[model samples]
Target: MKGRATGGLIVALLTLMLAACTVVDLDADGKPIMPKDPNAKPGYSNQTPQQIAESGWASRVQQPAEQQALSWADMETKSHTVKAGASESVFVRAGGVVTAFDNSNARERHLTMTINGKPVQVQIGPVLRSNAIRDAAGFRFDEFTNQVQYAQLTKALNRHAVKQLPAVDASWVGKPVQALLAVTMAPGKVDDVVAIQLQQGSP
Candidate 1:
């Protein structure tokens, strides 16, 4: 009876061991492995520029207050130097026309204007980045060189009928327009304009 009981006990232990071996899955190093879902889709990490633009991802990205403050501070500091060009302030109001709008470089749109009786080339962008002034000011990309808008602006400028006009217009090509200009200080050199506003009134 004792020997029969011992054989039965050994069989029960073997069964438990077999069950454990079947149930417990382990890696080669003895760590338990996580079961992966077969229906999961693969992730895409690389996105093209067009894809990014279409996604409007940049507008969703938020900058921390501290970072934004710093950016504004830096912008102010740079603007101050330009602003100092004014005898009492950094902003000078002047009238001008779009003497030339060169879009030769798709990324950087160069606008040459006759301001204060001098030809000033204004650099509009490296449009790929958010730091572009034109983008910041809400100017449409095509408005810079749209032919219809250009013709209208030129006609208005030629008429010289409007004494006070808005600083910016979709149709202000050849018109006498005013803008607040930020001048850069350089020794023995004509100051470059850092910023401009197409004004619609006498300053």
Candidate 2:
């Protein structure tokens, strides 16, 4: 009986190997003939990044705080909050805050921002792991037909943000200052806020 069972196992293994080695038939164009599904959606938008940026970005950034953004304090207590994996635009005016520019990572130069009243760390970046600026710019998902269009928009915004900052030097380090931050937020009690437009001055 044991010998019969071993033979059956060997036969099963051979069957699986044969199935795994099945070759796909090719078409006249030398491409594999894939089975067609009627429900498949495989189209992307032909809209250019320059066209997209020109159409709506100016109006989005120019919108007033009352119309376009919510206060940082209001988003807490569950009243106004961006859901997890969602993004929101916020305009914040903070004074006497503790912050420092850490250029340790040349690739991701960012300021470690610690607002006095709020318990959140604000990070400025062209390449940080947050997409608040991209998502919070009043853009609808349907506007972008594919992932590529969405990604390029973020790159355009980052270029604009880098121009908004003062020269990367020791002029504003460890000083008593005020900051007006137009930033984006994601869900959670307090974490990182990606600043879209940041302005600073001595208090």
Candidate 3:
């Protein structure tokens, strides 16, 4: 009888151990469901943008390729004839990498890319309509931008055929990139970049 009792106690201990090792899942109605695997990879949905930027996988992505020099003189020549009334779209094909992106303003975000080692701002937003007769001018990415303007710029950037690397903080610095810029020409003012298509390979 003593031996029989010891065996029953051992069985009870083993049952308790097994229970401790098991995981329990419940549905919204309190019904038991299968537990998920504890070893599965975690999802990024819960992570913030900052966290994603700092991830190990972020460093492994391919960088932009170097592109041929763009012709600013030619762009300036074309700018001379643009009539300022309604907004006119001028295609500017330039090749370069972003050197700086300024997000200091609460409303607008501005970036500068180097073409042939010359820094030029990537313009974002509406081009003003003027009636004065003046020489056509090359585009400029306006320095003063607000947060609302920055949002509009990002939306246009997203439409690019090639996915641009995130501009989080200064991650875009020194990264070679190219774009088909849609420049807006107005009288007496520098051309404004209203749209952009970021390219992957050389343009």
Instruction: Tell me the deviation in Å of residue 184 in model 1.
Output: 1.2
Please report the TM-score between candidate 1 and the true structure.
0.32
Best by lDDT: 2
Candidate that beats the other on lDDT, 2 or 3, i.e. the better one: 2
lDDT of 3 by residue, 136-202 (tens): 1221224213444433433333233123323334676677776655454554334554223454446
- The TM-score values for the models, in the order shown, are 0.32, 0.59, 0.39
lDDT of each: 0.41, 0.57, 0.47
- Model 1, position 158: C-alpha lDDT score: 18
Candidate 2 achieves a global lDDT of 0.57
Model 1 has an lDDT value of 0.41
Candidate 1: where is the Cα deviation over 4 Å?
Answer: 1-89, 126-171, 199-203
Candidate 2 local lDDT, 42-83, one digit each (tens)? 322655665565554566543543264554455453323557
- Report the lDDT tens digits of candidate 1 across residue range 177-203: 555443333333334443333543333
TM-score of candidate 2 against the unseen true structure: 0.59
- lDDT at 30, model 2: 95
